[model samples]
Target chain A: MKTAVSAPPARRPGGPAGRRRPGGGLSGRLGPLGVAAVAVAALLVLAALLAPVLAPYEPDIGSIVQRYLPPGPEHLLGTDQSGRDLLSRLLYGARTSLLGAAAVVVIAGVGGTLLALVATWFGGRVDAFIGRVLDLLFAFPNLLLAIIVVAVFGTGMAQATVALAMAYVPYTARVLRSVALRERRLPYVQAAELQGLSGVTVSGRHLLPNIAPQILTGAAINFGYAMIDLAALSFLGLGVQPPTADWGLMVSQGQDSLLQGYPQQSLLAGTCIVVAVAAFSVIGERLGGRAAGGRA
Target chain B: MNDDVKGTDGGVIGRAGGGSRRTAGAGGSGGSGAKGPGGAGGSGGNVIEISGLCKRFVTGRGSGRRTVDALDDVSLTVADGSCLAVVGESGSGKSTLARILVGLEAADAGEVVLAGRPVARRPRRAERRARARDIQMVFQDPNGSLNRRRTAGSAISEVLAAHHRVTGAEARRRVEELLEQVGLRPAHARSLPGELSGGQRQRVAIARALAAEPRVLVLDEAVAALDVSVQAQVLNLLSEIRRDRRLTYLFITHDLSVVRQVSEEVVVMRQGRIVERGSTTQVLDDPQHPYTRLLRDSAPRPGWRPVRAIGRDAAEVEA
Candidate 1:
């Protein structure tokens, strides 16, 4: 099988684009908005963790005499209808809200990604079966699914969070499955298979790492959605329960005060929810854009 | 399937048994030199034998679905330590044949015998790994063959770790040796596929394939993606490796020039069927089949002009 030898140079010295760094540095990739979103997210997490030390008054212990007090030296951001310090309740509420959303994201993201990897690795009927099941789950609205779980299991943060996660699985799974399917077809996966690596090894190492950016982006976006969904369930009196400092319950509790020309409690709680959700969304979008760019 | 053709060339078996590596001078005219058409037939110990192979792909859905035969009853054999080039246009079943042989795709109907053992269509994990130990494939696109996220050393080491019991320092040493054998520096092993040139990546892929130490190497358009100069270099490297390892090769390609350069026997395929098969010299010099003649004439050469005759002849071949 010999031919005329025309041995070229061993190394060609990679082009400028090739030599320039793997990730292009984190700060450079994240623009101003992404930075702000990350900052907001970090601050919210810190505030949640330090709620016990940060709050001047206990979130559940409020006086009826000091009810509906306006924002002043005594109570920043005013007092709720129960005369609870809104600042203290908001801080403690961040703990329940963020942790609950995190639980939903972790469960849904991990479960969905594993399902996607399995479907993609063992394609054909297996993929079709998993896809159909996910489609069935996809048909239900998230809140309705949460409501059914709450109705069946009785209202609590754990029940509501689990139900919301089930509802979210289809979203993450569908997106990840499509991407994983594309990654599965690449020659790298075939090379690994031809090397005698087991299907599990190929999927875990070659398949999963290639689609990790998509997983991160999906998880980030789902975190925001999970937060909003859980808060909505709490607002409807199906999650976190009364007297447990939660953003959604705070919104619902301030409703009566809203009608009496004192909208501080409801508006402030709603703004916190909006800010947190928006921050997560911005970060997710940036990561998504970067993932796309990396592919291109 | 073609039992009459078996054991026709005793010389090939003798050379294979000798297990002598090719020197630089001998390699220039090694396999294809001084051999007649009869010498192209397989020896008694065939490394790869496929018979009545068929693969059909159903694309689209419902009313739009159409079944395309990727391989239609293709049967061939490769003598141990010989390279058999399967040449055709795209969608002519050459690649499908390679894929099926390497156990990437299951044939709708047929049998594949590698190293005298029948391959299972629906192979279990152990069966699949056993088959991989006998045959490995090098894909067309070098960039796509290795994981972009992994370093070249890791890719090679993974294959070694999977097939052999080597680990840590032992594995790393073997990986470096494989790199040097492919004419790459040790430092190149640390670089990602993205950082390597097209030719460098192809060499890494070839190195990884060698890590399996298989009896057969199926190169599916392996060097087609490289530049002309780089393609020649890789082809030489492959020849040297095959000589050293006594590896049988199923060289699937559309390039007639490449077929002439690397293969002793050539099989002409068109639309999922083998049209002609013979020693490379006889087929290329004096083609018997009209499709073979068309393929020969269509290849670009010095002062060769594109003509209207090709299009009309292609239609006739289709008929």
Candidate 2:
């Protein structure tokens, strides 16, 4: 027994907070999937950022003479019915789609995370009230909800983004609340309470960190949903409006040229939407997996 | 032959006798000899003082169900630097009292004065945490008490970081020291709780409690799950730590024989109330409470025959 006391090694190698080797834990398991997702998202972001410098012709600089040009060196993906370069429009359209999805993710993640924490933390009447309110919001289909807001607020990127965020908030809040309620019952929560950590500290430090992966996963899934919904609305002329080079608007233009044998407009726009959603879905799945694995 | 396993049948008294023999071995094996944290001699105040403590747990929500009187009007004090065993059968409230005294569960009524201050009254957040730092607790099941998500090193370091105000390199050094102190190699820090055996995990748990430099340690059936031999070793380490650190301990257990060996004083609880309290000899050798007698009589003895089932000739002598 006396020897046991003296046996402790003098030099410990790790940090106090469980120093994870850079990208250790779940990242190790998620290696291939994470790399694939990052590579795709990075490509999209870079393409969107360099659209102006990379595009051969301005998306809106249409010419009647060159209109409906077939795929060639000068018009890589060919031109829409108006002779605007389809490649340029698709590249710039990424900026709008990615940005709209990002805004929706941020607004919904932060707003819904806070709301659900408050609901779960206070519980009783507060939780019941939020539950009912979320149920009411969930009743509306998100695209229809966004269309009504776009229809009501007169159609702009800001209004469409706001409408999409509101639609996604209920989903974010519901997921967050489920995780928070589960964490609230852990032994450490009671330990924290006994230690007198305030409700804020308990929720913020313990609850939020534990639930972030789930929320982020939900955000990723919602981002995909939001991107598709935004495009669909734009296709219906209720999003981004004309001359904005949105994928949905391109799809609408493509519909007009379908009889003329030019399928690039819809095909390129449809491909962009599919790729963006897939990028976010991959990232979301990896994050949610890590969260469930309980690795920081 | 494996020496310890060969010697496993020893009763509590035999284990203590065998433990003394091991201490003699320590003299020969101190190759990298250094004084460990729970250095071997000190004694001194009531490190834990409880008076009229009562805790009740409400059962089965909203059916007007009866509340479990987990602890009923229990008053006990542990001397500084001594192990006081609390023994009782399951649901007899032994663990409940330990939990309440450590502030894991609040007492429905009464006072738990630890190292001189009341454990009730809801101290400010920082102060309560500070108070908790002085009185650390270790639970029965090593697997359940520890957080499976964290590595053993991080698990130990968390308590140090929370209460010691140490950070970065200093905290890391201390955590390694703690890991080493608990008889595990420092390299074991990276291993998750799942990889460790039952005994090793308990050692880590003890190391975590030790990190706070607690004045009073509460062991809620701390060695109950270990094999008999490992249990003896842990008990010895605990006693060694208590003596060296001048630490006070409320050792909760259901085993009367184990209690008799570790504690100077023992408190036997029954139906949420303490039925007997006295020196180990006074309680074990001459139990006044009928419950304590039953507990003592029921405890398995290696070479004893039942008095009730003898032949008529032997039975007639009893009559």
Per-model tally of clashing residue pairs: 0, 2
Model 2 lDDT tens row, B1-319: 1211211221122223212211100111111112212221211134455666777877776787778888878776555555678888899898888777766566777777665566654455676687776687887877665555556777666677777677566776788788877778877776666667788889888888888777778888889999989899888888877655666678999888789768876778877877776668877888877677767866779885554533453334224
| Residue range A1-296, candidate 1, lDDT tens digits | 23313121233346222475455667666789999999999999999999999998899989999999999998987788889999999999999999999999999999999899989988999999999999888788889988998899999999999989989999999999999998888887998886657778999889889889888888888899999899999999899998999998888888999999889888988898999999998899898898888662
- How good is model 2 by TM-score? 0.71
Looking at candidate 2, what TM-score does chain B attain?
0.79
lDDT against the true structure, each candidate = 0.82, 0.73
lDDT of 1 by residue, B1-319 (tens): 1222222332275234223322111111223223222332332556676777889999999999999999888777666667878898899889998988888889999878776688898777788888888789999988789898888888998888888997476777788899999999877777778888899999999899888777788999999999999999999999888766667788999999998889877778887788777677777898878888888888899999875677788999668
Q: What is the lDDT of residue B26 in candidate 2?
A: 16
Which is the leading candidate under TM-score?
A: 1
What digit string (tens of lDDT, one per residue) describes model 2 on residues A1-296?
22244233342334332344323555464578777877898999999999998878887878888888989988888988888999999988889988988898899899899988999887879999999999998999988888888878888888888888888899999989988887775544544454445779778766786677688789877888889888877777777878988887888889978877878899889988898889888888877776677542
Best-performing candidate as measured by lDDT: 1
What DockQ do you compute for every candidate structure?
0.40, 0.13
